[model samples]
Target: MDFATWDDRVEKFRIPAIQYRALVESLQAENTIFNDDAKAFYQVDLVASLEMEPYQHQSEALAAWKLAGRQGVVVLPTAAGKTYLAQMAMQATPRTTLIVVPTLDLMHQWYAHLKAAFPDADVGLLGGGSRDKSSILVATYDSAAIHAETIGSMYALIIFDECHHLPTDFNRVIAEYAIAPYRLGLSATPERTDGKHADLNILIGKEVYRKRAEDLAGKALAEHEIVQIKVKLSQHERERYNKLMQIRNDFLRESKISLGSIQGWQHFVMASARSQAGRKAMLAHREAKEIALGTDGKIRILTDLLAEHYPDRILIFTADNNTVYKISNEFLIPAITHQTPVKERHEILTKFKEGEFKSLVASHVLNEGVDVPAARIAIILSGTGSVREYTQRLGRVLRKGQEANKQAILYEVVTEDTSEEGTSARRRNEPQRTQRTQSKEGEKKGDLKVVYGTGQKKTPRAAEQLGLWNDSGDTPNF
Candidate 1:
């Protein structure tokens, strides 16, 4: 009673590896007699090498995952002990395990964590040029997917870090081809712009448990405030930006297309590839966007913000690599981009953590998957409108550190009178544009509080709490 496959040369029946668990379950359900000889995973004694004070929220999360039969995703805020929670899961269900992460940085981080956590277990690395086999494997998504078929039955429990990435065309195969009867997914923001997050329910399981940033503000994470500071472009920059945007707008108006909807944007991209005029319009739009995101005014404001929070570790985030390098070169701070080599990136991050570098800049690479060191401040020069991106940047500085009651801050320097304002608002709100007033007023769920609007208070935290991912296991639909 196995998945059907025939080998012509051997003239023998073979079982499909991917269907191993289903066949085993079906066999057990019907009380069918069969000799099991293809098992590849075995239980091992695993205990945490270090003792940790059990957090109530983590305890609850582990309980919920176990209640769900260990096949679900746990959505928690960044730097709020997700790796610790995963270690707990491993200890509770000790078995051959595979942890898949999205980047080489994360792969190495997990390798270190697993080795430290399970000193006696045979922990191994599967990416970054080292392919070692052990009971516990930490692999990058690329390497794991390439070897998915061969290693399908090797692990019993598959843990997907940043599982939101699992729904991609190729990476999903890592989950599909594995016969791990148990699965756990970890993410700070699981919802994707493409709406592929729903596929996670089938690949891993439903959202078993979740905790937003505000939920554990002073406990698991540091008390933090997010302030919005708006800046305007110079007169010359403004005129040039307007002229470029006009060209793009004229194309859109003439073609009867709007950039407001995803479908319309897709149509515009296709049209852009088809004609010279359309392509020019696209180039105009891109250049205009660059101006808005990297206005000289932002740099002026950033210089002040950096000075205001001197001696404190800071992380600067930008939407474009150009802005990252510009800030790095102008301020003489180290920067990380996709182009940064793996060794160089690791060295820079280590130096930042050691206080050799008080400030560092990057373009999207520090968003997630990498273990960002504790920094008290985050300055966003530019970024997409994704709430996930906003939350992750904020989280880079929210890790509780040596300073008690340390009030972390995230200053978002936005360009005024451009598409950025609407984009900023979109990041803080869901599709329906519904706003529920909070008694506290505006700090939960990646919301930005205006520091210059009505009055300026010494405390940067806005006395506002707007909306949050509800406690009922998912983000609020609104």
Candidate 2:
């Protein structure tokens, strides 16, 4: 018999919540009977409301999770029925579930879907002015992390959608404090730039199942093509770009700093604030990037692409809000940013999906979380060299449409003879390229890139000339 003095201050002997799972299993291994009175959650009788059959991928993903003890991450491309996968998991576990999402939009979206899936159960929201809690709860990451201490023990199952965001400094506490014996993490791209995604191994679980975009392209996802459109800066713009870059490069050379590695970037950031010359060089660097990324030639190409794909759904992505607003005003297209109101965002998405709006523009806000309309064309005006960002943007068009034979096109407008050339090459190194990893034995996989508007499937001369067609990782001549 296990016995301990009951501490009146704590009411009874207490253990860390995370150890609850191990303790119960240990007691069961010894064939000891114990009351599970500490558990506030109980098994539920939930079922998926949708009559649609589960996809092969979804079924297989859930099976893999079950094999992993109902605690692991599943990596699937966006629009691959991850929501349905979550529903299956809820039915499998049938316990009080807390579904945490990255955004308020997703929180509400989950609330609506789960409520529909279980019409009788109360679906509560924990963010955006909604604070109801029930057997099933949907919460924004902010709200969940803030209330983890109180609500962590209330749920037996926890599902983290877009779980990549859970590794942040403030968000990790939700996982650490939660006693949910069953946990699931869902993400299209879980790798974080800061390497914090590694924490997910301890917080949630290891990756149990992964299906890349390439893995499901023809069957589950729409077959798509990536086209690189290299645009050159004009003479005046080139002159200014060269001058600013020269200043920045000189400062880098004098400081023996390289912008190639994360450490080098950190060093440059630290050195930039220590001296007057360094500060000027930093300003010069910013101006040069603006000139390169916001070149007029890209705008011209975008205009032509918009005309070429007129009346078809299009998504225009930019690196900054200024560029998004500029394109939105110039082309009279709808714009979406984080600053957009909730109702406005909902209306814009509804209209875009219903064919009332032909195109939409956004900075980084549209890359994930909110459900964007399925678009046929995606034009990258400017963006960071993040593979996750690129994949999310590409996913906006990867959902198969009613036209079975329609092809999705992603146009990457790259500025030639500038830093963007290298940036473009790096963004294509996502796991979508045959799920390749950074190891010595694994051979690199080829990308599904095609030449732009050439009516040919081969690489175009412009992309070849700018070295944007290859992942050779050669240094660019500034």
Report the CA-based lDDT of candidate 2 relative to the real structure.
0.82
Deviation (Å) of 312 in candidate 1: 1.2
Global CA lDDT computed for model 1: 0.82
RMSD of each: 7.4, 11.0
lDDT of each: 0.82, 0.82
lDDT of 1 by residue, 1-478 (tens): 5356789989997765556667877878899999876668778778778659867678778777776777899988888888989998888778889999988878888888888888888999998898888899999999999999877878888999999999999999998888787899999999998899999998898888777777777888888877777677889989999999999999999999998878999999998999999999999999989999988888878887788889999999999898889888899999999899978988998999999999999998888878888999998878888888887888898798787897888888777778887677777653522343233345422333364221223221111121221234521110
Worst 10 residues of 1 by lDDT: 460-469
- Model 2 agreement with the true structure over 306-387: per-residue lDDT tens digits: 8899989999999999998999999899999989997898899999999999999999998878888788899998999988
What TM-scores do the predictions have?
0.86, 0.86
Those runs of model 2 whose alpha carbons end farther than 4 Å from true positions after fitting are: 1-14, 430-478
In every candidate, how many clashes are there?
6, 0
